[model samples]
Target: MKTYQTGNIRNVVLLGSSKSGKTTLAEAMMFEGKVIDRRGTIEAKNTVSDNTEVEQIYQRSIYSTPLYTEFMDNKLNIIDTPGQDDFVGGVIAGFKVADAGIMIVNATQGVEVGTEIFARYAEQHKMPLVVGVNQLDSEKAAWDTTVDSLKQAFGNKVVPVQFPVAVGPGFDGFVDVLKQKFYRFKDENGTREDLEIPAEYADQAEEYRLALMEAAAQNDEELMEKYFETNDLTFPEMIKGLNLGILAGSVMPVFCLSAKKDIGVKRLMEFVINATPSPAKDVEVTVDGTEVPCDSSKETALFFYRTSVEQHLGEVSYFKVMSGKLTEGMDLVNPVTGAKERVTQIYAVAGKKKEKVSEMMAGDLGCTVKLKTVKTNQTLAVPSVDWEFKSIDFPQSKFRTAIKAKDEKDEEKLGEALNKYSAEDPTIEVLYAKELKQTIISGQGEHHINILKWHLNNVYKLEVELFAPRISYRETITKVATASYRHKKQSGGAGQFGEVHLLIEPFVEGAPQNNRFKIDGKEMVLNIKGKEEYTMDWGGKLEYYNCIVGGAIDARFMPAILKGIMEKMEEGPLTGSYARDIRVYVYDGKMHPVDSNEISFKLASRNAFKEAFRNAGPKIMEPIFNVEILVPSDCMGDVMSDLQNRRAMIEGMSSVKGFEVLKARVPLAELYKYSTTLSSLTSGRATFTMEYAEYSQVPADVQDKLLKAYQEEEGDE
Candidate 1:
């Protein structure tokens, strides 16, 4: 590898649907660039991009693999990303750093669901796109239909720069519309010879060439005028116009290729090297709130977009030089952790292999070995520079399961492995739900979680189990009731003697109407003194009235009584669920001067609260989530029916981006595997997102079941 300036660097990401031949196309590009002697096939599980064990077993990419190839005096850094929607995090990570995207569309499948998702992501990132109609030599390939679908889905901006002359068993050549010449591949080695346009396809070639001219002219006013006057534009002029159009996202040049046969790949590489913008050209990066340009002369700053753990190498960090230059052994500050780290080595990443590089120029993507403080989405810069690049925005996790180590002894190891994995992939999250007493692992979908599990078992050698998480139900009381308890234990020496009288009721804002605290329109107030209201930390209120005006119970013991009441509130009397939104009034009590200590008052108070709660009508409340499902209109009826079966309350329905959006509130219990179920129902065409909404009382039958289950578990314990 040789040092190159930012202008000589090209960062592009490969994106498409599963089995769209993105990996094969990448292999073809590498082979043409002479970086690899022979191409590796997906069926053999020897492709450079999908090198992981899980990917090999699944026969799909699970991570974004970065590789570089030099062609036409430029270093092309290609980030090959996974195409599955479940592994979209990899695609988004690649898009975050790449200057442009090459969206590969399967000729046989046309524009499928995954293709639409990648297009939307590219549009969201404002990335310039180059559409590659791949697998052109397949028997089922329909080039014309696929081209039409591309135009319809992506608009008039999509214009073919190359059209296949013949697309089946005899497919060996394509017409270059821009050059108005025929390129015939000599063999499977991608050797091509230029030839004159065939007599039979000359008319069709001319028509497509005219369309390309018009598409290119739409970018610049001067080009449009020149094309209108002469009815044609020179090759150089067309290239210039198309470059501007691509940079402005006003043109999407479509290329045809049969990656398996290595045909037309050389031409695609030529176009990319000639027309694609360099990383330093018009690329705007921001540090903190200040916009920074990609200038090598500026202060050193690097933004890490991906992180992974290699077999021998502990932590390999992939980054892009956002500004200035990154040299080996240079000390940089990790602004995220405010720690200074020395860059010990710099390497140009080629799949799992790395080549030592002296330095990485501005806008170039490379990797650093074992930075202690550096992690994904962290900014490394000079200590004097008080700036950090914006972090990548990953999608929220849509599916979750309660996970635990198969062997109790491996709990700590499982925790460590999960933390490292989650750090590498931001889309996966591990959380401990204290109320539910479960360690929950969440990801995009079932496939995404399965990969993590595979890594845990195979890579880390830790067996784990995943199951549905327990619902975090809450307990609350209704109505008003009074209970009294006395703790008098005079065994031998100093005795424990205390008595407590408490009036329990639901808390309500504003003054009591008709001399009653209404709990669901039921009068539940009791007469009390010193009615001082206190708010509990866990969503409830405690109204204490020390009607012991004559000091029936010492004032010093009141705090102990409140502490005992709080303990019970944390683990409620009914079902042991956290109690909320209730008021307890201590109107009267008795105490012995010699034996009434804090312990005695605490015990008496705890027993009194349990008795009062049992009489007050306790109810269980379950957590609700605000769920939004986006699906095609055709699947809306089935989705609605599924939601109804899950006891979901439909709030509203609307249309967004050609999809029907359904909004509803559903209980967390019913949504355990909703992501997988929705994917099955819609054939992976629909997606959904959810967030915590509020807690509401469970239905009477559900409440009964929960209480019974809790009691049975307690008995077993």
Candidate 2:
């Protein structure tokens, strides 16, 4: 591969809603650039971007892939991204490293929820935005309708540089409105010939051209005055203003193309090469805390945006050399961890394969192989670099499951494999329950977790069982109680002797001044809720208190009492859940100095806690989550009813795109496996997101059942 050095290396990311043909469009560009001899197809398991087994079998992009192309005179590093909502993390990561973006929208569907998601993201980052209306060759592909939708969704700034000349069965190709030229595609074989714009739609094309011109002219006062005076601008002049608008981050250029039919793609290629701003000309920020310009004149602060798992290629990382040159065998500091590692090997990656390279220029994107500690979203801080770019924002994962390896002996290997898998995908969470001894895995949805399972089986050669996660509830006390105990042992020269004298008081607000606890033997005390009174308050009341003046209990032994109380809190006052906020006062107690250390007091405190907790009232608390559900209006009644049954409270509601966005708080226990239920209720059109809200007191009957179940399960274990 030849290094195309023209100060014109443009790295652009391909992003859009799911099923928008982003990967296919990337393949078309590669094919047109002659970077590859043949185009790879998604379903055929041969696409250049969908290379991973998870992606190949799923027939979708699981991660972003970097494809390089030489168009016109500059090198284009096109980062193709997964369009599925669950894998949206990859799409966001792709944007962090690209100077500009090619957001694709299906011609028939126009703008969608996912498209809006990325558009807002691009706008937030001030990235140069470009739109590609793809699949013009397919049936129901209405060019006019898509253009209208774009206008409505994105506003007037989304000016089309070109429009499709036909739609659906009549689809042929696109005509360059400004240049007044049309490209006729030979067929799916991708051969094209230039032609004059049809005379019939000339008048309709004029309307959009004026719209484009007015949009472009607004970017420059001189151009605006010229357009107002003459009511016209030449094609080359319009292109110039549009480029300025793009560089100014005030306008996004929309173009037409068919990825599968290879129509109008060649025009897009020319526009990108000629108009897109080079990396050195775009915005720049520091990786550490120093200011660094986007100039090759200084040492570089290269940042890695993504990584991939390939059977042949070991840990290929897609990175941007922010300010300086990056070459094989050069060392750089990862600003995040302050770790240093050599580049070792530099390569240009296309999905799964790699082409070895010697160096990549500053402000350009390339990949390096076998870096030891680099991870996604990590920035390498070189000297003279000051500020770090904004962190990538990812969506909350909704899918979840608890998983454990099938073979006990494979536990270590399973853990190692899961760590690697989770590193590549930040959307997945791995958890272990110490009590249950189960390793649980969670992801965005059923499909998302299913893909992780597939990787574990195929890549790591590990078998596993996946189950729904069980709710983790905590226990505490609600009342205050006091207990005293004595420990004596006489079998040696120094007999072990200790006594615990403590009043367990319910926690209170004023307890801060009175919260001091004593330890004569084994005991712990906290002025917390539910320990204020001998009666079970299920909250703090501060029922127990004492001022042991004149050292009725030796102050030296106070530490021993605290140790025992700590154990009591951990083991729990009620059914061994856990306890807190109970104040223990050791007014009087005896301890043998030989056996009255922290360890002996810890044992005594455990006994004291059990006795005090039995007298005090203990209770359980369950987690609640704030859930935002967006579903079609027709399903709102069903959703509300279901939420009511789950003891949820509706907080707010709004309407969007024939759907209702409902904000509610529901217990986490009621929300497990909610994705499947929401799919069924909304007929697979509704989506939801949730976050940890708060811990709420469980209802009386529910609490009883949960407690009973916990006791029975503990006994069985």
Candidate 3:
């Protein structure tokens, strides 16, 4: 493979909704460029982009695949990304490396939820966009309606540069509005013959061409003046103005293609190579709090955007040259880990296949095999350079499940496989919730988690089971109470003998410092001497006082009593949940000089604290999560009603972009399997994000049910 300069390289990512023909378009582009002798259909499980076993089984792309095609002495690096929202990490990875985005909209379905999500990401990255209406030959295809929907969703920046001459069955070709010529399909081999526009569609073509000219002229003041004077733009002037507008994000050129039939793909390739921005074209990147241009003459730096474990290749790290050229056998330092890795081989990757490349210039995406310490989002640069690129920020996992190994002997294997998969995909999170005593596996959605399960079962030969994760609840008190306990054992010499009196109360942040209580119908005002308040690490407070003026129990034994109380707090008396926000006052106790050791006082203190807690209005607290849901306006009522049924409090409601945003607070227990339910109710058109809010006391009925269930489980155990 020949190395190209930064000016000759064009990096673009393909993004759209599921079944939008992104992968098929990629196959057509590769076939037209002659990179592959024949295009492989998705149903056949042989497309270059969707080559993985998982993708073959699912019949869709699961990972972002980088493929390069040469046209007109320029190298176009196409990063084909998955369209499902479950694999959003791949789409984000593609955006990080690509200089521009080519969003594919299905002509039949028009705009979808996935399309809206990826479009927002492209806008966030400030990447120029080229919209392609694909699958024009489908029976339900409506080119004009799809274009109208794009304009409504994406604003007035969308302008048609190409229109299908004939759609649905007997679809032949399309007219290039920019070039003012009809490109008739010559054969099934993707060859096109240039011809004059037919008289029947000439008026429609002229109207679209005028609109294209207006859109192009609006980007440049000089072009606007020229257009106003002559009411037209020459071919070269119009192309120049359109390119400038695209780079500025003020104009989006929409093209039409029938990827399945191998029609109109070559023209799309030509537009990408000719009009898309190059790596060296005004791309500003920040390093170490300083902004720098992507110049080939600067110090060498590259960012690893994706990592995966291939069958025979081990670890493959895909990266894009950020500033300078990257050559084979270069010793690059990883600033993230402070480790040095020698790049032994550089390859141009197309799906799983790799072509040996001697060098990759700035802005070009390529892969290096087996970098020992490099991972995704890590920067590899020259040793003398003292700067690093920023890392990509991935979305947090929304769905979680507890996983366990099916075979006891494969526990270690399960852990290793999970860690490997999590490393490859940052969106997958593996955590061991110590409080719940469960291994939680979380990802974007149910499909995302199921894919990991598939890999564990098929790839690593480790079977596993998944279940709902347990919620981390807490226990607390509401009122004050007193309890006494005595421990006496005189069976043998030096038998244990101790007695403890404890006063328990709810700990408030700020309250009056008076100590008053009524015992046996008598009011007593106690003076707190040597009162000490200690804050528990888990949350809550403990106030201990030496109101035992006569020293009923030795001072040295107080530490042992406090330790015992803490132990009980960790495993609460009521549901064994962690107890919090309580004050324990050890006012008086009895001890035997010979038998009352640390063990005796500890046992007496623990039993007394449990008794006091049981009588002091104990309650269970469940965690609350702040959930933000985005759904279509038509489904807003159903979603809101469903949330209310799940014990959710609607905080606020508003509109974001075109979707209705509902903000609510919901209990963690009620939100189990919520992702699945939401998908079913909205037909996979709604999305949501949630984060931990605060803990609140459960209702009386719910608390009773929880206590009963826990007691039954403990009895069974």
Worst 10 residues of 2 by lDDT: 528-537
TM-score, per-candidate, Cα-based: 0.94, 0.86, 0.95
Per-residue lDDT tens digits of candidate 1, residues 1-717? 888899998889999999999999999988887778888999988887889888898898888899988888788899998988889998888877888888999999999989987888888888889989999898999899999999878889999998997788778999998977898988888888999998998889989999999988888899999999999898888999999888888999999999999987878878887788887764455645687788888888999998888879889999999888889999999876889889999999879878899998898899988788788888999887866888898988999999999999999999899999999999999998887788899999999999999989898999999999987778888778778999999999999988998878777667472235555566655455555667766565666665565777888899899878888888888788888877777867888879989999999999999899888988888889999988888899899999999989999999975789999999998999999999999989898889999889899999989889989989999
Each prediction's Cα RMSD? 2.6, 5.2, 2.2
- Tell me the RMSD of model 2 versus the true structure: 5.2
lDDT for every model? 0.87, 0.74, 0.86
In model 3, state the lDDT of residue 119: 85
- Residues 1-717, candidate 2: write the lDDT tens digits: 666452778888888887899999988888887888788887687888887766777777877788887677778889888776666677677777777888899987988767876776677667788889998888878777887888777777778878876678667777787777877887876788788878987886788788889988998999999999999998777878888988777777888878988887778878876677777765554434455666776776777777766677668777887776777788778765778888888887766667788877777778887888888778776645444665566667787777878998998999999889888887787878664357777776777788888888987899998886776565655655577777766777666667666665556446454544443554554433222234322332223334355544465555556656655565565556545455566555566756655455556656776787677666677778999998878999998998998889899999975678999999988887788788778765677889997666788899789778868978899
Rank candidates, TM-score, best first. 3, 1, 2
Q: List the residue pairs that clash in candidate 3.
A: none
Highest lDDT scorer: 1
lDDT of 2: 0.74
Tens digits of per-residue lDDT, candidate 3, 7-56, equal: 98888999999889989988888787778889899988888899899998
Sort the candidates on lDDT, descending order: 1, 3, 2
Error of 2 at 299 (Å): 0.6
